[model samples]
Target chain A: MSDQTENEESPLAGEAYTLTSEPKLIDGRRVLGVVPGKPSTGESKDLIDEDAVMVWPHLLVRHAVAALAVMLLVLLLALLFDAPLREIANPNLTPNPEKAPWYFAALQELLAHFHPLVAGILVPTGILFGLAALPYLDRNAYLKPRHRKVAITAFTAFLGIWIILTLVGFAFRGPNWGWVWPWNEWYGEL
Target chain B: MKVMDRVRHSMMGRSFFRAPDRVTTRDVAAGHWANFFLHIYPVKMRRKEISFRYSWYLGAISTVLFGSLVASGVYLMFFYVPSPANAYGDIINLETQVAFGQYIRNVHRWSAHLMVLAVSFHMARVFYRGAYKSPREFNWVIGVVLLLLTLLLSFTGYLLPWDQLAYWAVTVGTGMATYVPFIGDRVSEILLGGPAVGASTLIRFYVLHVALLPAVLVVVLAVHLWRWRKDSMLDMERSEP
Candidate 1:
């Protein structure tokens, strides 16, 4: 009897506002009508309002302008500087302390410290796998900075390590892959 | 809407060239809807998705860099020969003789470097924003793949110049592959086509750099963008500071 009163008072007021077992007649017709449930806070789809501004002149225009700006910057940089093209590759005359491109400099630095397999292959593969695994490992939904303290810390550490290693490769390593400060005369001689 | 209207009224609009009456918002939506390529992006999006600070537009910058690289690379290729004997000489000729050739090469090189950086920064931004949660997880995985592809693209292109920088960098780069346990030597051999970087390696890298990798990146990027549209920027309701 209490259930009936509750149903009568509020058609959609509680957590279990699913359809009741008792069928009801509406305008002389029996119906399995909806007893709408209270909105679920956990559901993101319900919270998002689909009505949004159109993409044209908003999204598309901004994207176009940003791309154009990038192109212009590239053009300016291209005109101001020349791409380094050293004497045609002489395999017989290897440059001392030869370096891989800057992007790979960190991996090369890693190779300097650990076994090649560990530094070059294992660590890189691990990093990639870890990145792919991030979403699965941390399933918390809140985007607030306070809620994600640990994740933010771990990522910052990873980024800091990479930057440090890259700097070590770029300015520290010299001839015969030996350590030499960038300010030293021998550093530029290479 | 008003600006679009004036443009439609003017002679410069594409729709105006065809039919003056076909430039309304409904027509624009219909146009995007009917087209296969354009349909990947919805005609409407939450305004916050485009806000400058929301994403810092790093992804867009990376895409632009990639476009610049492709354009400059294709232009450079016209005067380049993949063979060992002619490759270095071809590069010399390109710089010394060809019009805008040096500029094009510069742009390609810089763009490649910039793309790698931009992609990294974009990933970092995504992570910092906690945008990888919930239904957006798979998209994050795809983003990782794209990042790997970007690195591979940069590495493979490093060899094409056939210069000292190109030769030794790739040699050292490929030599790292040889440290991978059982199949290490086999991997290096396959990559270089021999015990060392040579003609086979150059041609192989050329093919991968120019054809295979870019094609794969494009397909994966398509899926990334499509999924982004499907997911529509993680929890925009909670986006406010």
Candidate 2:
């Protein structure tokens, strides 16, 4: 069927063309006259095929370097700063500020303003479910951010707000969960 | 290179490798396919996909940090016990008495913090790159699971030190759980194994940090990587045309 279409479209349709030698078989198909020009699909398709590369050395080498770099950073950190060890845990005496880990600082900050149910349970659950549902929710098939304005905007806004809240909860808040300059009165713990 | 070639031709190497020497692209691909460690990786990827800007290698960095944690954590576990009386004392003894204990503990601490950062960055990178599209959607979900697991792992390990920071931080962290309408108390009870963060809580968090969560993360991470390898070659962007 493709051959029929090609023959009909060919400029040499009505002209008599002869093979220089006996017709050879290629890939179980009778050899037609070899066209000595670019493929109909164009050069970009071939370039796309060339874009793929073996992962053995190409990717593995990069991964190895990354691994080494991270290891070195960890080592430097370990050497420079000792892991903080405060007084032994005293359950009867609670710390004043009573902060959570840095990662959960955003939720902790939210808890300061909102009800525990809203800030703790509902918000975190909503975020998790929303993240898991993102691909299905935003059905736009475009890969570029410019083509995906809504998703990009929503994510960036969430990211920015979360980061700010985390910084506030981790560093800015002091005793009684009151706002304080981090440099003056540092309450942040590892 | 010559030495590697000679080894490849050796009888022992031939028996071990089960593939021809890496002379051509096909040979390299065959060798990659035959290796157990490389099973998690696709044999080939788009050149752009492998570049530094594409991923910033955050996933790789996170995995390496996990590896560092496992190594350093196991070493620390040898000198410590999970009890109210001994936990803090053990840490003190380990840091002062045992050789390289302080260094190893520091490595574990820093690695845990870095792992959290790397994993979160990985998720954000994946989001901005629109890497969570159709064929890769499930992998993205798996990634979310990983992020949660990373947080859980760090939180659980935080209590193992038995310091004041660990105690109060965990208390504040777990205190939020009681806000859940139903089964809130039950969840907190199950997690602490008692009314409050006591000996029972210490042991519970220890077991979770050292044993259960790591096992689950390993399994989930395996599935995540397997799916990644399977979907690596898919042209999600081009499929529309």
For every model in order, the TM-score on chain A comes to: 0.68, 0.75
What is the Cα-based lDDT of residue A97 in candidate 1? 85
Write candidate 1's Cα lDDT for A1-190 as tens digits. 2433343334334544246554233222333445634434542334234457667667778888889888888888889978887888887998988898887788988998899989899999999999999999987777878887988888999999999888788778888778887777343211
In order, candidate lDDTs are 0.81, 0.89
Task: Give the DockQ of candidate 2.
Answer: 0.38
Q: Interface RMSDs of all predictions?
A: 7.4, 4.6
RMSD of each: 12.1, 8.4
Q: Candidate 1 lDDT (Cα, whole model)?
A: 0.81
Return the lDDT, model 1, position B171: 96
Write out the backbone clash pairs for model 1.
none
Worst 10 residues of 2 chain B by lDDT: B20-29
Q: At residue A116, what lDDT does model 2 achieve? A: 96
Worst lDDT run of 10 residues, candidate 2 chain A, spans A21-30
